[model samples]
Target: MAQSWQRSYADMKVRDLEFMVGERVLLKVSPMNGVMRFGKKGKLSPRYIGSFEIVKSIGEVLYQLALPSGLSCVHPVFHISILKKYHQGGAHVIQWDSMLLDQKLTFEEVTILDRPIQNSRSKDIASVKV
Candidate 1:
């Protein structure tokens, strides 16, 4: 009975969402995953990529996306928590670009935007901005 009550409490905090086939959604990329590729001093990196089309909804909380050729190695299916339904004219936007991903799903950094040096008591640290 306690387990059932706990399950219900957890479910109550989660929003019930369902995506339809052909809908566009943004896929989230966490800092730990994407930060290494772009040397941005680990700051100002985008947390999500794409307004990719939803190919199919897998059960209730997972959806398959039509990812680009560069991300072919990545599994198309993702959990609902990592996805946000694309809203028309919303602030979150990206100029769609072809990104190359390795087998490990890490992307190549295209350009270096800026580089700044940080001075510490022990040593001077150089940080690359992408």
Candidate 2:
């Protein structure tokens, strides 16, 4: 019975989310300092600040994200409403060497340095001799 249940769940197709951990995504974020005139001038800026890795899921509404610039931050676990996927060209067209050069940080670097500040602090203290 357990096996059957698991199989059914696995067969279900999850909606392809626009943003995922380790995915290079472009966010249509609004600048915090922009002037709002009559609410009609609100604009979204398509700024690509490298890639972000999702660290943890805070319930179903929030996610902890690690930015490429080595900053850890949380973002609203927005439904597909506010996120868009950045599609790199097809595999057939892009070469592996070029793709590697474009990446600013390796996966290991992101995994190690992009953790929450609290976590990083604890690790740092452990490394230092008391």
Candidate 3:
């Protein structure tokens, strides 16, 4: 006798993406500043500080992120647009103090230094002229 009703889809194809609880992932946000705040002004300040590990998935969309500061929060369903593969490289391991001391540093430090100047410019633009 022949077997009846063979499975159409392969088992490998049906497997869910395996993400561990403590897997480090980079949380991405738009440059619009208030996008993550969900329409609230002056409350949300979004920037790429560093990578956060996945604490757990609340459901299908929402995920709990464990920040480096040892704080965790569950909200914000991060789509693929905001997610990028966290590349482990020399750039990620360089200490702030060491970078400041090193004469030859990576390009990432340029942005870190530039941010303060950018903030100052914004403050000047927002200030009322006497």
Can you write out model 2's per-residue Cα lDDT over 1-130, one digit (the tens) per residue?
9999998898785555534456544433333345332222434322233334465555554455554332223233433433455566533221222212112212111123333333463464223211
- Per-residue CA lDDT of candidate 3, range 1-130, in tens? 1232234344535544445567766654333443432222354433333466677766664666664322223243454334444657626432322222111111122222222222463463333222
Rank order (by TM-score, best first): 1, 3, 2
Query: What TM-score does prediction 2 earn?
Result: 0.30
Model 3 lDDT at residue 76: 36
Worst 10 residues of 3 by lDDT: 99-108
**TM-scores for all predictions:** 0.62, 0.30, 0.35
Where does candidate 1 clash, by residue pair? none
Best by TM-score: 1
TM-score winner between candidates 1 and 3: 1
RMSD, one per candidate, in order: 4.7, 19.7, 14.4
How far is 116's C-alpha from truth in model 3 (Å)? 20
Q: Evaluate model 1: give its TM-score.
A: 0.62
What is the Cα root-mean-square deviation between model 1 and the actual structure? 4.7
| C-alpha lDDT (0 to 100) for residue 43 of candidate 1 | 52
The 10-residue segment of model 1 with minimum total lDDT is: 31-40
Give the local distance difference test score of model 1.
0.74
